[model samples]
Target: MVAERKTHPYLSLMNSYLIDSPQPSSISYWYNLGSLLGLCLVIQICSGLFLAMHYCSDITLAFDSVEHIMRDVNYGWLIRYLHATGASFFFVCIYLHIGKAIYYGSYRKPRTLVWVIGVIILIATMATGFLGYCLVYGQMSHWGATVITNLFSAIPWVGNDIVQFIWGGFSVSNPTIHRFFAFHFVLPFILAALVVLHFLALHTHGSSNPLGITGNIDRIAFHPYFSFKDLITVFFLVLIICLFVFFSPNTLGHPNNYIPGNPMVTPASIVPEWYFLPFYAILRSIPNKLGGVVGMFSALLILLFLPLLDRSLYRGLAFKPLSKFFFWLFVFNFILLGNIGHLHVEVPFINLGIYCTIAYFSYFLIIVPTISTLENILFYLGRSNK
Candidate 1:
């Protein structure tokens, strides 16, 4: 039960954010993804703190430390599995959250700050995940770190210097692992702060609804209404996470990572985690070293321009049939990029990756503005004829 209003500052703030805040009455299950994401952030931070307690960041002992946690420490395996599985699920929830925002035009106008902070959070989370992955110091972890850090060398003048700065040396070594562990440990706290900012920005204008209309006319308290509804999705999320943690712990991981790091031998195929597949595919699609690097970063940075690019008179895609259709097609193209990223960069796969990269950028650059403008004209024309 929500407590009665009081003079205490903490209680008053809680009332503002949780108990008394108004939410759209018509908002559906998609809105629940935000709460799910918050839960995921908490799970990751707690488990990672515990894992770090016994983890040794030295390259020689890093792999062994992970084994010690799994085989020697008490319930360490559960914590480790939870952290790993939670990383994947975090991306799942965030991707859906971004998709919901786009579908409802939540990034437009007053809510642009919220959406921009979210994209920054996405970038931070990617960095944190990459750092954590390297802390394992297994075969895949070591080589993956080497490969990804080397991407910085594609720059024109100071690229090699930047790579060296990141490695703390000429290559991935003892100092590199040590630095990664430190950054991996620190970034989550920054991520948590960013999440708080995201909430503040969102609450400034309240939540968006399905019909693309103002939510003020029909609103409900967040506490007992949608808070309980959020629990429904949380239950399903926990069920799925548990299934992965206990039944199929390594299903999302590479087998090569099980072996200890070896500088002399390289995995025949080195790929980032599955969550990174689409962008990784974009990176590989370009033939030139520098071009691929620019293309990959552009793919992410382009999302920030959505608010300006969408020229429609209204928010949300519910009334825009053409925009809705193209949105789903864009989703398909993204999935295709991820699929291509999993294959070897040769023959048909290279060609396929190139085509998908083009489609991916075209959806934002050309399709969105054109479709939005066309829909605006049709809306007025139909009204006049009626």
Candidate 2:
């Protein structure tokens, strides 16, 4: 029936694949985050493009141009605020989306590819966010870029060359800003394409429900049912973001960023945005420059192995008693690391950050795999006794 409609092939494909797709009826409001993430991506891209229209990527004009947008350009402040705030909210939605997946065991079996693509999207988003932040050419932006890009120098013999390559000269200057701005503009479209692939992969296996069941007994069409649900969720989320944009536009921003970039002086402390703090904490925890760089990248790259590391047969945390406890512990540990990341690199804070970083890695590398194996073994033994 879908094929016989004789409409445009693209429209017909969307109707057959998306509008008429079957989704698990037991899926909770948590599943709405997937759609919310899509909306956030669109908001970022649209607002970013408009801001780019009047943005000057030159080091001298970059900071002042942003000021011009805020003070002179009609509704430019609205667009700029939306783009900035949307980046933070984008992470908010993706983190919740990931948490939902972890709780429901969405990364298992056939959907593993979907999870992998999602992780890639996350990495690309991080890169894009970092580049966008640097385009502001403020105190934090300048020092942050200098410090982060120089981390490449930790790479043995080619370290200096890598840093020079990234700088496009001897230091972070006009060429560096121009290159970062170009990539920042281009990467979002690549991310959008990856998101399309993510949806294709998701549809290949359908969505995982809160119950973690794959049965067809309770399923519904994606049209009016889930569509309206997703719409409502997006609307609510946009309302919250709008509140932040209008009422407290700078709440998520740092005070240091208000000052224009000056190579002559450095801020007392350099910090990335809140969303990057957990990994940043891991980076700063290690004493060695190379080791710290490796640790930071490992923190993110290790997530790729989560589907393999978690050996439990149970599909959801709800069914796994011990795993559930560890899951929330991991969450708390992550927040602790983020808090530590914001503190000065002195005395107790450094020690605390190191400890939290260890806890963070241990959760995935040691605790999850070990408890999962032990729990499965005990389950089988109990069943045999019964």
Candidate 3:
């Protein structure tokens, strides 16, 4: 039975995935965010597939079917809430993952493509999340879509055409709901593909650890060491998710969505899902509809160019004194934008939105480039690199 050839060791290269490499440093909790993102993707997909079994994409019966699953199917509520809450958790993980990248300089040099893929994932997730919100066919979902799609009209020349074509008609209706659901169901797979691209880039450059030292060969393998660490975080994550599913399933949800879609009634406030509040604020900051939309999309588009924005010789947060301050300030500004996004788009809120939107872009356009320049000057002056 043993007919193995002497030159056949490389034939089982796939087996190497399970073995640990010695390239990674002693990573901590921050390292878990990327793997946790992968876990969330799986949870979201499974929960969604189950819910899809009972979901009726038809606008007329969509709300009724969701109600039926709640009232009739055994433990359907648990599954539905898990899927819903998984979404919020998913974005939180990505935010932390993105921050981890920034803090440790994972976006520099060889890992820039990884960062690029992450941004693409971020945008795609937002697009699908927006569509997913509309799939519920509730009053809030309807009006939320109305407010969001109207933003496309900000495009100047062909904005109106883009908006109408996307909706499959002049307004949000059955066609809109159906298309949203189809896209919602489809986007996560595309996200998974991007994730594959991301990991390939990560593997090619090797993972950037806390020290932000990527070129060192004296590190640990990803198989046993990193995978074991990630598995521990996965358990804790599930515990948190289960708490939301079993206890406060409705906590993150708007009460208005409980009611079925009603054209005669409009919700007092048109807010998006909580995860999208920051960009939602950016969108509403402008007085003009098309302008608001452009601002929102452009804000994200700017992130794709970050490798050029920052030109510092050093990458980690600890060494760059000036860059460190601006980084934290920008983080706070982002959080503030999210808080303001939940408020009514009036007076003080609009004013705050305008400032935050400007500040938001400035962090990339000005603060980042300025700090990087300051670092280079300091470096040339022999200020400090140690």
Best by lDDT: 1
- Name the lDDT of candidate 2: 0.91
Q: Report the alpha-carbon TM-score of model 3 versus the true structure.
A: 0.93
Output the better candidate (1/3) by lDDT: 1
Structure candidate 1, residue pairs in collision: none
Query: If both were scored by TM-score, which would come out higher, candidate 2 or candidate 3?
Result: 2
Among these predictions, the greatest TM-score belongs to 1
Q: Residue 384, candidate 3: how far off, in angstroms? A: 9.5
Residue-level lDDT of model 3, residues 260-349, one tens digit each, is 889789888877888888888998788777677778889888888888888887777767778788889889999999999889877888
In order, the Cα lDDT scores of the candidates are 0.93, 0.91, 0.83
Q: How well does each candidate superpose onto the true structure, as a TM-score?
A: 0.98, 0.97, 0.93
Q: Residue 33's C-alpha lDDT in candidate 2?
A: 91
Ranking by TM-score: 1, 2, 3
Query: After best superposition, candidate 1 residue 288: deviation in angstroms?
Result: 1.0
Q: Each model's RMSD to truth, in Å?
A: 1.1, 1.4, 2.7
